[model samples]
Target: MSLDSWAVPSNTGSMELTDTTPVHLIHVDPDVNMARFYGIELQPTLFGEVSVLRTWGRIGTNGQAMMVTYDDEAQAADALHELERQKRRRGYVPAGT
Candidate 1:
Protein backbone atom coordinates (compact mmCIF):
# COMPACT_ATOMS: atom_id res chain seq x y z
CA MET A 1 0.00 0.00 0.00
CA SER A 2 1.14 3.51 -0.79
CA LEU A 3 0.59 6.76 1.08
CA ASP A 4 -1.25 8.33 -1.84
CA SER A 5 -4.11 5.88 -1.51
CA TRP A 6 -4.85 7.07 1.98
CA ALA A 7 -5.40 10.68 1.01
CA VAL A 8 -8.84 12.22 0.76
CA PRO A 9 -9.14 14.39 -2.30
CA SER A 10 -11.30 17.41 -1.76
CA ASN A 11 -12.99 19.22 -4.59
CA THR A 12 -10.85 22.15 -3.57
CA GLY A 13 -7.80 20.34 -5.10
CA SER A 14 -5.85 19.76 -1.92
CA MET A 15 -5.20 16.27 -0.70
CA GLU A 16 -5.75 15.27 2.92
CA LEU A 17 -2.71 13.23 3.90
CA THR A 18 -4.06 10.23 5.73
CA ASP A 19 -1.13 7.93 5.17
CA THR A 20 1.24 10.32 6.86
CA THR A 21 0.29 10.99 10.45
CA PRO A 22 0.05 14.64 11.48
CA VAL A 23 0.63 15.85 7.93
CA HIS A 24 -2.06 18.08 6.50
CA LEU A 25 -2.90 20.23 3.51
CA ILE A 26 -5.96 22.35 2.99
CA HIS A 27 -7.00 24.40 0.00
CA VAL A 28 -10.13 26.44 -0.01
CA ASP A 29 -11.48 28.45 -2.89
CA PRO A 30 -14.15 30.78 -1.80
CA ASP A 31 -16.10 32.93 -4.25
CA VAL A 32 -13.29 35.30 -5.18
CA ASN A 33 -10.00 33.75 -4.12
CA MET A 34 -8.09 30.61 -3.31
CA ALA A 35 -6.23 29.92 -0.10
CA ARG A 36 -3.96 27.03 0.76
CA PHE A 37 -2.13 25.69 3.78
CA TYR A 38 0.52 23.01 3.95
CA GLY A 39 2.91 21.59 6.53
CA ILE A 40 5.91 19.45 5.78
CA GLU A 41 9.41 18.50 6.83
CA LEU A 42 12.44 20.34 5.58
CA GLN A 43 15.02 18.72 3.37
CA PRO A 44 18.09 17.31 5.11
CA THR A 45 20.32 19.85 3.43
CA LEU A 46 18.25 22.56 5.10
CA PHE A 47 19.17 21.20 8.52
CA GLY A 48 15.71 19.73 9.21
CA GLU A 49 13.79 22.96 9.36
CA VAL A 50 10.08 22.32 9.00
CA SER A 51 7.91 24.75 7.09
CA VAL A 52 4.41 25.86 6.36
CA LEU A 53 3.67 27.01 2.86
CA ARG A 54 0.67 29.20 2.31
CA THR A 55 -0.77 30.72 -0.82
CA TRP A 56 -3.57 32.95 -1.93
CA GLY A 57 -4.66 33.97 -5.43
CA ARG A 58 -7.53 35.16 -7.47
CA ILE A 59 -9.88 32.38 -8.20
CA GLY A 60 -8.92 30.70 -11.50
CA THR A 61 -5.92 32.99 -11.71
CA ASN A 62 -2.35 33.09 -10.44
CA GLY A 63 -1.35 33.79 -6.84
CA GLN A 64 1.60 34.15 -4.48
CA ALA A 65 3.33 31.57 -2.32
CA MET A 66 4.76 32.06 1.17
CA MET A 67 7.02 29.72 3.08
CA VAL A 68 7.61 30.05 6.83
CA THR A 69 10.37 27.92 8.22
CA TYR A 70 10.54 26.64 11.78
CA ASP A 71 13.45 25.36 13.79
CA ASP A 72 11.63 22.13 14.52
CA GLU A 73 8.69 19.98 13.43
CA ALA A 74 6.67 20.79 16.56
CA GLN A 75 6.55 24.45 15.77
CA ALA A 76 5.70 23.75 12.16
CA ALA A 77 2.89 21.47 13.20
CA ASP A 78 1.51 24.10 15.53
CA ALA A 79 1.48 26.64 12.77
CA LEU A 80 -0.25 24.19 10.50
CA HIS A 81 -2.82 23.44 13.17
CA GLU A 82 -3.60 27.08 13.69
CA LEU A 83 -4.12 27.73 9.99
CA GLU A 84 -6.16 24.59 9.61
CA ARG A 85 -8.42 25.79 12.40
CA GLN A 86 -9.00 29.05 10.61
CA LYS A 87 -9.78 27.28 7.36
CA ARG A 88 -12.15 24.91 9.06
CA ARG A 89 -13.91 27.79 10.70
CA ARG A 90 -14.41 29.16 7.22
CA GLY A 91 -15.99 25.85 6.16
CA TYR A 92 -13.18 24.20 4.23
CA VAL A 93 -13.70 20.48 3.92
CA PRO A 94 -11.80 17.53 2.57
CA ALA A 95 -13.27 16.58 -0.81
CA GLY A 96 -13.37 12.84 -1.39
CA THR A 97 -15.58 10.45 0.49
Candidate 2:
Protein backbone atom coordinates (compact mmCIF):
# COMPACT_ATOMS: atom_id res chain seq x y z
CA MET A 1 0.00 0.00 0.00
CA SER A 2 0.97 3.60 -0.53
CA LEU A 3 0.78 6.52 1.87
CA ASP A 4 -1.43 9.56 1.27
CA SER A 5 1.39 12.04 1.94
CA TRP A 6 0.45 12.43 5.62
CA ALA A 7 1.32 8.94 6.74
CA VAL A 8 3.85 9.60 9.52
CA PRO A 9 5.49 12.51 7.81
CA SER A 10 7.29 15.41 9.54
CA ASN A 11 5.32 17.25 12.20
CA THR A 12 4.32 20.83 11.55
CA GLY A 13 2.75 22.81 14.35
CA SER A 14 3.23 25.30 17.16
CA MET A 15 4.43 22.51 19.42
CA GLU A 16 7.76 22.62 17.64
CA LEU A 17 9.72 25.44 19.21
CA THR A 18 13.35 25.01 18.18
CA ASP A 19 14.93 25.21 14.71
CA THR A 20 15.39 21.47 14.64
CA THR A 21 13.14 19.68 12.16
CA PRO A 22 9.96 18.21 13.54
CA VAL A 23 9.22 14.56 12.91
CA HIS A 24 5.64 14.02 14.07
CA LEU A 25 3.25 14.32 17.00
CA ILE A 26 0.70 11.72 18.07
CA HIS A 27 -1.88 12.85 20.62
CA VAL A 28 -4.44 10.34 21.82
CA ASP A 29 -7.01 10.72 24.52
CA PRO A 30 -8.37 7.36 25.56
CA ASP A 31 -11.20 9.11 27.40
CA VAL A 32 -11.52 12.14 25.08
CA ASN A 33 -12.92 14.32 27.84
CA MET A 34 -9.65 15.88 29.00
CA ALA A 35 -9.39 12.86 31.22
CA ARG A 36 -6.01 11.91 29.75
CA PHE A 37 -3.70 12.28 26.78
CA TYR A 38 -0.85 10.25 25.33
CA GLY A 39 1.30 12.27 22.99
CA ILE A 40 4.69 12.02 21.28
CA GLU A 41 6.79 14.33 19.13
CA LEU A 42 9.95 13.43 17.19
CA GLN A 43 12.46 16.21 16.64
CA PRO A 44 15.85 16.61 14.99
CA THR A 45 19.09 17.78 16.58
CA LEU A 46 22.31 19.04 15.06
CA PHE A 47 24.58 17.95 17.88
CA GLY A 48 23.84 14.87 19.95
CA GLU A 49 20.88 12.54 19.45
CA VAL A 50 17.36 12.93 18.10
CA SER A 51 14.66 14.00 20.54
CA VAL A 52 11.48 12.12 21.32
CA LEU A 53 8.95 13.87 23.51
CA ARG A 54 6.26 11.96 25.35
CA THR A 55 3.24 13.31 27.20
CA TRP A 56 0.67 11.34 29.14
CA GLY A 57 -1.89 11.38 31.92
CA ARG A 58 -4.50 14.12 32.42
CA ILE A 59 -4.03 16.99 30.00
CA GLY A 60 -4.45 19.98 32.27
CA THR A 61 -4.30 18.23 35.60
CA ASN A 62 -1.87 15.38 35.93
CA GLY A 63 -0.29 15.20 32.48
CA GLN A 64 3.47 15.08 32.05
CA ALA A 65 5.74 15.74 29.08
CA MET A 66 9.25 14.42 28.79
CA MET A 67 11.93 14.29 26.09
CA VAL A 68 14.44 11.54 25.55
CA THR A 69 17.40 11.57 23.17
CA TYR A 70 18.53 8.77 20.87
CA ASP A 71 22.03 8.04 19.66
CA ASP A 72 21.12 8.27 15.95
CA GLU A 73 18.40 8.71 13.38
CA ALA A 74 17.77 5.00 12.88
CA GLN A 75 17.22 4.47 16.57
CA ALA A 76 14.86 7.42 16.68
CA ALA A 77 12.93 6.10 13.68
CA ASP A 78 12.64 2.72 15.32
CA ALA A 79 11.28 4.28 18.47
CA LEU A 80 8.82 6.32 16.46
CA HIS A 81 7.51 3.29 14.62
CA GLU A 82 7.18 1.33 17.82
CA LEU A 83 5.26 4.15 19.46
CA GLU A 84 2.95 4.63 16.48
CA ARG A 85 2.19 0.94 16.51
CA GLN A 86 1.39 0.95 20.19
CA LYS A 87 -0.82 4.02 19.87
CA ARG A 88 -2.72 2.51 16.94
CA ARG A 89 -3.26 -0.62 18.96
CA ARG A 90 -4.87 1.51 21.64
CA GLY A 91 -7.31 3.12 19.15
CA TYR A 92 -5.47 6.42 19.19
CA VAL A 93 -6.03 8.55 16.10
CA PRO A 94 -4.40 11.69 14.76
CA ALA A 95 -5.15 14.88 16.61
CA GLY A 96 -7.44 17.68 15.42
CA THR A 97 -10.94 17.86 13.94
- Candidate 2: tens digits of C-alpha lDDT, residues 1-97: 5677657766554333343433333444457553445666677666656778777765465568788888776686677678867876776656452
Q: What lDDT score goes with residue 32 in model 2? A: 52
Candidate 1 positional error at 25, Å:
7.4
lDDT of 1 by residue, 1-97 (tens): 8988779654641222222344334566667566554433222114545556665544344456667877766676677777767766765554331
Candidate 2: list runs displaced more than 4 Å: 1-34, 60-62
Error of 1 at 61 (Å): 2.2
TM-score of every candidate? 0.50, 0.54
Candidate 1 TM-score over all chains jointly: 0.50
Count of residue pairs whose backbone atoms collide, per candidate:
2, 1
Instruction: Using lDDT, give the best candidate's number.
Output: 2
68: Cα error in model 1, Å: 0.8
